[model samples]
Target: MLEKIKRRIEKHQAQPIGEQRTFAVFLPLVKVDEEWHVLYEVRSNHISQPGETSFPGGAVEEGESFEEAAVRETMEELNVSKESIEVYGEIDFIFNQSHHIRCFVGELKHINPDQLQPNEEVASVFTIPLRYLKENEPEYHTVTLKTEYNHDFPFELISNGKKYKFGKRKHKVPFYRLPNQFLWGFTADFTHRFIEIISEDTNFLEGKNEK
Candidate 1:
């Protein structure tokens, strides 16, 4: 088994990176009242993207495996022990121009609102029924990407550089509506993939109550 793993690793090619960061996030599926729901964390106002909703994760630390970083971030944000989390598998990789994200799906051993101990990094925690996501689709919007160069960039260095016009890139972002909350960007994208994965197992999802 070790030899096979080593062979696979040796043959794998790392993705190219040009100052792009890597992050890992775990989607925690908690069973509550015979229904499966996904837990989401709201970033504290003091942190980046304050008040924005996201999964329990952050940038991968140096020399840390993606799975390790995912689990560590979950534990830190949720204040739960490692034993409470059972990582199943990873879904598709998410990437933008500036960063890459790994989304891991996992089950929470216990689900109790009172037991949660969110730290300063997290403003609040909430759960949405998985059935709702499976039944609904996110609204998509196209946003244009603009590029800006530094003031010191020398236009004289390259021929016709001053006259060069950069083309605009369009990105489609999806947003999901819940009572009063909105799930968009990376979180919504990850949820969409999760719904796709679970939809394949009719028996598993049918066991839970939808609503």
Candidate 2:
């Protein structure tokens, strides 16, 4: 039994239980006239969530690492080569009940946004200065997530039955107002958190920029 357990554990990768969808996004930093900017993509009209502003990324493929997925998606969406991207590091990740997103930060070298023809999944690409993002604040919306039990739930089997008092959670949905774009949802949340870590809460970005 011990040997069997060891084998099974060695083969198992830690992941959330039940149905889960994993994703990856690359935050591309482009240096323009000595200022750093972050690139974003507008989803194509034919794709899901068309007109929404998001980073260049997509789902993680089988047998691919999260970093590789980010690079592949960026190349596909932006029509760039892997050599053009210099991945600084992985910053933070985001997750929900059914979705897990891994994020990576990188710099795009020697590429003009206007010159590249994005794939069908991307309608257009735009960039915003990182300094502006660090200087501003994002508006937040709080939402409560309440669990709903199925009618056939076996409450009798648990110590807490119908009156078991399942816990409810509160989530903060962040919204960032751009000049001509409405950046919100998980995209906005990730950006906001990134800025907070490097600028507001920590001096990481500043330190990185100095060197």
- Candidate number of the best lDDT: 1
Error of 1 at 198 (Å): 1.9
Candidate 2 structure quality by residue, lDDT tens digits, 2-119: 9999999999999777777899999898877777788889898989999999999889999999999999999988999999998988877887678989989888999877687999
Name the weakest run of 10 consecutive residues (lDDT summed) in model 1.
202-211
The digit string of per-residue lDDT tens for model 1 on 4-60 reads 999999999997667779999999988767777899998998899988999999999
lDDT at residue 172 of model 2 (Cα atoms): 86
| Candidate 2 local Cα displacement, residue 75, angstroms | 0.3
Give the CA lDDT, 0 to 100, for residue 47 in model 1: 91
Q: Extract clashing residue pairs from model 2.
A: none
Count the clashes in each prediction.
0, 0
- Full-model lDDT for every candidate: 0.87, 0.86
The TM-score, computed over Cα atoms with residue i paired to residue i, of candidate 2 is 0.82
